[model samples]
Target: MNTMKKLAAISLVTAALAAPADLTASARPARATGLPAAAKGCVPAMIDNFMTGAYRSPDLTTGSVTNTESGAMLGGRRTTRFQVAGNPFGFPSTAVVAPGDKSLLAVSSGYKGPTALAVFYGLRSEAHPEVLRADLSCFKRFEVNFVANDLPLNINVEVKSASSPTVYQCGVNTEAGQTNGFRLEFPFDCFVTNDPAHPPVDWTRIDRVLLLIQSASAMAANDYAINFFRLAS
Candidate 1:
């Protein structure tokens, strides 16, 4: 079906799923802070499941070296150590700022699995934050980014109770010279889900969103990384 039709179908499904009760309460969008007034960009939000590792060089002068061409004797061996850094997911944090009316919500999930991760937004201490039952009429667009290394990745974002998925193909690119730094952006209609069966019709009521990253066949260290998140006004 066409994109419009697909969106409509997902909306209908979401309405049905949310018919039981209103979970999110209507509230005014939060104002921006610590950012330039004209700087229409993203900022950091809460991060989860981040991994920590270090790069190290090997040393070869601790032991005596031996060499034998025909007898197969080899040189000395050396060991290197790696220190683990604390993962940021466990920290008590908040998005530097919240989205404005007509704002954009951006999130990153460390590689986990194929299930779309759920992201919830609400007052700092509200109960049932995941249920976005608020009137989010001001939001117009949703931009998502999945940051990682040189590996092919795909993501599908879904609003809970909706019936479709927002499919995002995270194109792979060459790793830049900078270590521990990379990002990708995928822009989508805030209301439409890439999958007709899972449209984000309830975005208007969304206080939180969930993202699911499809798993790959092979796994590698630093295989997944989610640097930051932002909500554009």
Candidate 2:
């Protein structure tokens, strides 16, 4: 998304917030720019242009998985999962980690129909243990990207967790129907310690990852993609 366009959108949102009743009349459909006209529903377009620019040094390790093929599996069957480990690109100068800080970058191409994608990472302490909880560290973060045609995109993020089942859902953006795309970055401090209450991350043990993609409604056609990076010392 263009900076000027973002500014204009923010301005409109601010104006709407200032006067709730005048929202309907004050809010005018923004003239579409480079967006496709024939594009009826939401189409997932990769916002690669914004990422190509210069970023601070210490390049972070990054990876991604898409839901175009197998789709997300919930209960019965398994799903295709991908993983890239240990700062694939080597740590960049800018990729710095403080005592309690964790940073990440996540993005996705726009989706035309309806689709969802989630990416998560965890830090484990020590090797095997009698109690499962003893070996697990902290669930660094969880991120979700949702999109649908002719509707706005929804982006959500949460910090800290022990163990949680991954699930995906689809719905209409009834409130902000004009949203077409979104991007987010998160930073935090604190790690799962080795104590009984807060166990240390078992770096020696293998970490698990899960990705889910589901089409809840009929005539649903869309693409789901995500790229994530972790910053460490």
Candidate 3:
């Protein structure tokens, strides 16, 4: 599937957040020059450490499962479900608590169509799942810690806002042969949209945090271990 089309599909089905603007083919957000300096008195917050949480896995309609986990933010002990969507033709995909129960491991097999394994954050009510709104204006950037194997995978980080019809995104590409764990930082400004009329992201009304990991090729298999996702000063 085309990268832009694949991302747009995920945005539409998962949260109904909004449409995505024309994006760059490069492995980074369009119009992002570099990371900017943090603002004064900027406080740090953890989105998900993938640790210190217990969750129940329930099989979803797409043959994937949802992990209703205990979170460490938003009053601590916030219960939210992390979803796995777009597994090609119901191609088997799994999101599990990795060995040692320290990180979340997402794996996809026989990848044909773009599969987006997403982890949800912020406030949510199970009774009304679509209403997940959060305020992250206090932070200047986002930090993702994960380990990538040699397998080909396209990793994208996306954000949705309550006040706009554009979904903001930035690419976080990993080295082909690098197996070591690494941390990537993306400033909020790095997230942009091709639509100039709508804001790229409304930080104060951020409703969703989406991480998309798609197999790089057809019938390709890949896996990723996520350590944590955070917002920082």
Candidate 4:
């Protein structure tokens, strides 16, 4: 899709959900630099590294990860989903972590419309009575290390709070010409809703977080992989 159409699709998706209540129109897109001076060289809080190579089905359509690594934000669960219901091009042909590979690799086969390989964070484990949440108030941005094969990918975040079950989303796209893979930073402020009546996203009570992929063109298969995802200061 061209720039105008791509942006229009983004706006339609967010408007269908609801608008943000507390955010200003001054929000910006993802940036490579500009971290606060105090946060320079600060260690990131790990969200997932996809090191376990775990998947629920043989086709790899669904899978779960229980992060045991140190510095991970939540110890509960994270899973992948490739929703195929309204998609005419069929589900992703490949979505798995190969035996020796540490990254979660996903390959789409000419899928159309808005579909994402979603990673859900802070899932309630069997031992927990309630949904687990990660307090990310201290983090100012999200750092994602990934490679895309010239696919116009949009990285979206969905969060929920105690007062509302409604899911609010905000996202940024990978910069053009970064097909070789790059580490991009998405600041928290970039995630905003369109409806002012909707409750603002509460970073302190974050019940769930999702990293999604949206491609503008679907004429061919899309290759994407992630090495690490984190919340940083």
Candidate 5:
């Protein structure tokens, strides 16, 4: 799991879902002070260091976030491949740029455990499992930096491993109208494992990262927005 940081820090969360229900959205790899010490041969695999904005973008778009990049990654714009339950999935999930000119990524998800996900297809080759894990080894933790408003009053972030089909999820306690930058950390241990044959997380081929929001407390407020994001440490 990743270390959730607000203001690039955390204030001892109350566990479980908390506070009021407000998706009036707004929007952590490490406490990366500045860049990195040097470009490691691969994505920094430093367990002690949170690598942010230091990895190769490969084909990174100009935008700060990748909510819109999922379509291209999965070779489709709207998809039902990520849903675990709640059949009769709704129409296309949306990724909208909020006010302040590309300020936030506003993602509108459907009811019934709405999930928004994007895959970085082939970012790491399955041909080299050893190489893949070695490259991403430093990243034992995962967290996102964002401002929470109206979206997933009770939030869970899921990551699908390449080795298994189970979607591992960790609950995040989101604070409303929080432009102060809240982060939910999901470490490897936090992911639930139903497959005994393969590990819950296949670091070598991490596949896709999905944002599964709890059914919106208020349907109208299910959609949410965030300032930006960071994947590091």
Candidate 6:
């Protein structure tokens, strides 16, 4: 979808949130962005443009029979059940095949619901029991390029590891959403892991990654559209 349509999605989602529980494409709340330039020593583990089939449901990858709010597939996507949710404000969400008639992933924080879906990707490591893993030791940072409804906002991200109880988490700010769209980048240390040992990030043992959003805060806003993503070096 073009930037205009993407921005308009915010209105659609807002209207949807203001209305009934069930939302339609014509008006719904939900969306997810882009990256910046490469930094030195950045090694990409796995990046998907949604153009090619890279991620799928955990079931398809692990051959397990558990039902999660799955939408991480090569050709499929998911729209959040809630158009408006969260604490102070409602946030509708979506994880669908973006570009609507094409083959790409679309994530949204259009609403502020506490519940959001996960698009699982990256490496899988038995070393980390449940989460996925990757060796990011070679790199120092990661970045992604996505469309932004607003640049001054922050988006949520989580990196899971097998070595500790808490996952690496952080809030990244959006870039210029009008001209170049949004690009966000951050170093490994920026992510806060509850383990005081903060045991060395088993870069090689990274378990899994997820794209997340709160949907809304104290106010309402537009949604974002992602175009490309990568872990920079």
Best by TM-score: 3
- Candidate 1 has a TM-score of 0.35
Write the residue-wise lDDT of candidate 3 on 103-209 in tens digits. Answer: 66544344453445655543233322333445578888888776655566666666766657567777655555557877777788777665768755778766556
- Lowest-scoring 10 consecutive residues by lDDT in candidate 4? 22-31
CA lDDT for candidate 6 = 0.40
Q: What's model 2's TM-score?
A: 0.23
Residue-level lDDT tens digits of model 1 in 197-229 = 643454334434433332222321123434334
TM-score, every prediction: 0.35, 0.23, 0.65, 0.63, 0.46, 0.53
Please, what are the lDDT tens digits per residue for candidate 6 over residues 13-104? Answer: 22322111111112211111122222332223335555543333221111121122223321122222122333344333344544334444
Score residue 69 of candidate 1 by CA lDDT.
13
Angstrom error of the Cα, residue 16, model 5: value is 30
What's model 4's lDDT at 181?
70
Alpha-carbon RMSD, candidate 5:
13.8
Clashes of 1: 22
Of the two candidates 1 and 6, the one with more favorable TM-score, higher being better, is: 6
Model 2 agreement with the true structure over 45-136: per-residue lDDT tens digits = 22111122222222223332211111111111111222122232232212111111222222222222333333222111111111111111
- Evaluate model 3: give its lDDT: 0.52
Rank candidates by lDDT, best first. Answer: 3, 4, 6, 5, 1, 2
Off by over 4 Å in 1: 1-130, 144-147, 161-183, 186-202, 217-222
Model 5: per-residue Cα lDDT over 9-109, one tens digit each: 11111111111111011000111222243245224322211111112121211112231221211211211112212324344444453334345544555
lDDT of 5: 0.36
What is the lDDT for 84 in model 4?
Answer: 31
Those runs of model 2 whose alpha carbons end farther than 4 Å from true positions after fitting are 1-139, 144-180, 183-206, 229-233
